[model samples]
Target chain A: MVEKTPILDTLTYVFLVLGILIVGFPIIYALIAASLPIEDVSKVPMPLIPGDYLLANFTTAWTKGNLGTQLINSFIMASGITIGKISVSLIGAFSIVYFDYRLRKIAFISVFCTLMLPVEVRILPTYEMAANLLGPIQSLVNVMHLNWLIDWFANYDIDISLNLSLLDTYPGLILPLVASATCTFLFRQFFLTIPEELCEAAKMDGASAMTFFRKILLPLSKTNIAALVVIEFVYGWNQYLWPLLITTNPKMMTAVIGLQNIIPQADDLPFWNVAMAGSLIVMLPPVLVVLLMQRWFVKGLVDPEK
Target chain B: MIKRSIFSNPYLPYLLILPQILVTLTFFYWPAFDGLINSMLVSDPFGNYSRFVWFKNFIALFTDFLYLKSIGITLMFSLATAITSMSLGLLIATLANRALKGKAIIRTMLIWPYAVAPAISGILWLFLLHPSYGVVALAIKKFLGVDWNPVLHGGDAMVMVIMASAWKEISYNFVFFIAGMQAIPKSLIEAAAMDGASPFRRFWNITLPLLSPTLFFLMVMNIIYSFFETFGVIHTMTQGGPGGSTNILVYKVYQDGFIGLNLGSSSAQSVVLMSIIIVVTILQFKYVEKKVQYTG
Candidate 1:
């Protein structure tokens, strides 16, 4: 931009146009394909132009793919993750930034440590734990030879065994995924920028920590909360491996995974049109969020301090 | 950094952090610890017999040709995906940064791909490249006279997954690259331009060096992206098929543990992956710390 020579200016536009073409080609093709008739979709060289079957393909996809349930599941999961992660992270960040506590350093380190252990790295164990939330405790009791203690208590008509499973449930889908430190770190970084005088003023007013957080800090965090919501919502909606691992029930499957179900079976004709429509449906929500909240999304993604 | 004026409530602080700590411990530490323990314990496929054999599973993993092959494949895939995506991202970002018109519209158009899930992106590419009726596949066969079936060809499958992964990641790298480009002081560029340096020379001499930190950060992020995040892409695309061509480490762990029921090997693989992530994360943090010092 300092000295944009005419030739260089033309070259820039040329490359950008080419880049956009290549980048946009797949989605454009999918749109065109999705609009085509079922038979046209399977043509050796599928029709390039849009057709009249857009609604028909979408209808078939929605009905056959069980997309209604899947979309609802995805919405719940994405919203749950955004809300749960933000609230937990907000409080955790508040504790770290605004309070002096004995275990603060340990808590910070533990949360930071989770950054390295993404769900993929601990998939099997996480699945097993989700299958039985109390498995670790049960194992510990067995390891500690506390069966006799339980038996003794049982003899006195007391039972101490505990069992819970999170699989195929919304909490299961949301909670494990929420146990990351990105949002906490982001909030902590943002909190560090706030003036110390605000806390002093709140303290002078004899406001409780909770009240200050509610009345002052929460109001200040609106932009940050919105940014993180955009990022986390997209993240939650796009999750595939975790949901695929835990949600065995069709009714519980998220839209991204459920898109697979809409694909015609191996024996059936490959109705690429219907599948393309389903792909569009599954992609719409997160795409819309990103487009609508472009500023916050970019800030959440690129802000180094976060 | 603690605030100068702060709240001092021991119980409330603990209560505030308790949810985060509890969720982390149960979901992260518990599973990670279980993975470490399970890595040492060999169990039959049916889970009827089990015994702790310290480091045996890891030793077997290193010795096994298939596992070693998988490691090689994963490294290759990660590098290919990262480099392809980063280069394409840089190209677009550089162009977009220079263009004098419609900057916002161009950015909006290009960045929507970032929102497309890897699996959905894979499906989109699949429709384009599917063997029987895929438009591009047919064109390649017709014009190039080359069979383009990912289903049957290992090389083709690898290319397919890489294309899909790179396509999805370009928007992320593009966003970062644009930010990096904008952060480079315009005065520096203008001074270079005034000094009779060619556009290419100025960019190569100044812009590239200044952009190295962002480049390095994006490199690590992209490698991590291809390693773990592309599970959906590989799963939906080829399922690591055509004779185990695309079986990246993450997908292999899923396959071995859930499908093959090799708990010991799977757990060992998970430990290896965790260690890989930790090392990469440490490397990133170290570089980031150095960058902070340099900038400060």
Candidate 2:
């Protein structure tokens, strides 16, 4: 025991309780506001407890605010991005960590260079690339005189255009994000811990690298895969700036982007109850993922380099 | 950090890592290089006529008062956020580490806020601090008899954003702090206690010096986060409004490039921001990964 100071122990408890309340106050406030009726919520000093109008406020936020479509869009985008990022980084990490090849160091360095170039830094050019990819593709096709290729695809109801923009599409949202520097970095670190004897034994048995990966390496990385999923899913779900920039249509808005719309301007007599309901609805999935998968969440976040 | 190859195929490794390499080349390097090139090009309003203008955009950006103000704002915001979040995080972590009951549950509750989106934290704070009809704003008006209008006041908006960003980051700092504290050997602390060093004295002398590495790492992370990741916070909360008082560098780049349509200047800003990131990254590799030591 450090000490038997009852006063200090009580202070510690008090500090912990206060910390929890302060940390949780926003969420608690959102919930209470979501449940309260408009009249109650409009008052100067709103009630702090949950009210009976939870379902009503939720229906208003969901149906009227167009949150349902946004939520679905968010789910689709998040899943697409998560799958894309994980698969790409998985194979990339596999080759880099477990194999020796030409320009291996160059490949590793190129991926590592991305750590310094976040989306925010490369904002304008990335937007330009996503919005105008057809320019270069068309020039290549024209130079190669591949008009039949276009006609061949056109026969199947696929009309390729000179101004083929990917904005507001699922692939558009996911593709630019699929290349994850840290994912490969972390997975490669994980693969290094796998014993060298296993690889030597597999070689002695005449097993190919792909077979070894499928049988031994994949199964060995279940924890890493799970941790990666939680982290990537949250990341993809919470994307704000990229979606806000690319998707101009409200129909394609993710839940996070939908937040800007749902929030009312200060001058208006906005329904605080409805906005609070929408906020809670937006936060529900990610928060639930954290609470339910608490251990994996902690592991993924704390030990990123492990 | 190098792992020997289990297989000996030249084509297979290239095939495996090709997808990530292609994506990185397409998205990251190309755009970054484009930004660098764009900073050197002089373009008209429509970009219909552009000529090479070496260093002119950079000169324009360095001389602009608004750009300089944004730089100052970013520095202040990052420092304020890093200090407040880390201190509060350390305080809570110490308490949680010693508390007797519901320790796991408390840690869970404390850490879940890390999953909340930065924009959501912005909205949450906005809800509480909005000038008209905001709950906390109303409380302030009634209790302190001051007009608490973050919407109109520049300083108030800055404070609101700082609070929101720090709130979103506290859980992250707390988790790392707890991990760092737990890694310290118990015998050292027990021996110090046996030597009659008071709890406060022991903490100031022993725990702090030992936790310096984690402290340095988190400080760097918090600074980087404030520089780039607080875009959502500033966007959702202030939108760099009230005459650009809360406009950080990231927000300025976005607003200038996208909204203001000054591609050259925006690209210049991006170049400057990228340089900052490069320096910070180097610091992390040199300090954090190197187990930067502090003598007790």
Candidate 3:
């Protein structure tokens, strides 16, 4: 806020350069290393500049590691999760904020509690859900003996059995994240700011509640929707622990999981260049999202309550 | 704050709310409930045929040496990450907050790394610090003549993880700190300067006090981040290696629950993490409540 002295100006530049160096060095180094052949990477005093085998390394990582398929899988999972989260949380926000509902406060409070209870804490049972896929629903059907009733329907020449699974699928990857507590909170906050007169005007026009929401609230919520989409998409793309735990098939693996899968976990040394190439690829989408839609990303993160 | 006006829809509101509620109940509440039950019900070493045993898992955790050490290491790691990242963030933020050339460029350069996933960041750092093939590690070896292997040394592993965690977090803290500082009224800063306050004096007197709210907010967020979100980092980098030196509470919960197959103990650890999160969340609400009261 004060007038900067020459010393301070130099210090500021120094700090900027230092910050950039500290932050960007590893990423750049990895990108550089990713380009080189394995022999070049293994040698002491590794090259700091770009290597000549960039295309070859990329192609190798793609063909051998199945990086292309993993990227597609990750895209599907991320977009699926993002859509699921936005839709569920948006309707939730719409319901609680615009409509008068009994136990609304209870619903809100429970959502808040869910914010505190991250999936990491409930990994064991959540893993159970992922493993069994439809265990909860199947058990419900069995407990209530809906199968006997299904047998009763079988007399009408319709067969129904209640066995299902979501293991190694997009729905499995996306379903558990549909209950996005943070997005709900952000949406609720956004909806509260919307002037009540919109709804009043809709009512004056004899608009039904659904129409009122569709025409009024939904349109007004474009910013919140965009912001939450970016945030949730990054979250979905960056999901490591859940997808890592659930997905066993290579065909089902996402890019992030694939990156780690390529890395060495035990005594043997790994293919460093290939691993680095995979990491660089894994980092692309989220970095691009934040860089491209930076305004919404920043606003969504820093000033959500505003 | 209740909405002043709302639609009256008895049926449609419930219909709208049902999807989110059902998802929340199934994924969040049901699993949490299962974890609660599993915590109290002790299972065999092989995790089969568990009978109800209240609080024993928690008791065993307290009595266990490694679990206690994990608590200490987690505290140290969280505090280290938060403080390191936040201080560096504050420093760089202050530097960039000045009327410097290429201000937008500097910020754009600094902020993009926040989008890098924690695990990816860990992998990058691991590549840099790897024993035999790492470029930086080789440079450090030649310059300082110290053997560098995080895979074998606990202290080195902790440092590596803290560095990786702090690296990703610095951009986040930088954003908030810059935003917090920018929100301060320039008139106050100028007034302090006009009153013959030096830049350092003005910063300590006015800017820092004004930034305390943001500081406190980031403190809570960073701590929670280190607890829950650093799973990817630990998983990729150390995997609680070098004899459980870098194992934080969250990772330990995973290590025990998923890898060790001690369902009761892992569930107990989850319950402990639950209480910890509850405390942090309450602290956040308390701060928000105080801010509300202050504003009112």
DockQ, Cα level, model 1: 0.84
lDDT of 1: 0.91
Q: Across residues A1-306, which tens digit of lDDT does each residue of candidate 2 receive?
A: 477778888998998999999999888888898899888887777877789999999998898679989999999998898888888888899998888776889999989878755788778888887887665576467667577676676655344458868799988888888865988888888888888898889888999999999998899888888878877888888888888899998889898888787787766666878888888888888878877887876787778632
Better of 2 and 3 by DockQ: 2
TM-scores, all models, native as reference: 0.97, 0.94, 0.93
Better of 1 and 3 by DockQ: 1
Model 3 RMSD vs true structure:
3.5
Lowest-sum lDDT 10-residue window in model 1 chain B? B287-296
Docking class of 1: high
RMSD to true structure for each model, in Å: 2.0, 3.9, 3.5
Segments of candidate 2 deviating more than 4 angstroms: A134-162, B142-145
Q: Which run of 10 residues does model 3 chain A get worst, by summed lDDT? A: A155-164
Could you give candidate 3's per-residue lDDT for residues A102-136 as a string of tens digits?
78888888876787567877888887776675667
Mark the 10 consecutive residues where model 3 chain B has the least summed lDDT.
Answer: B287-296
Best by lDDT: 1
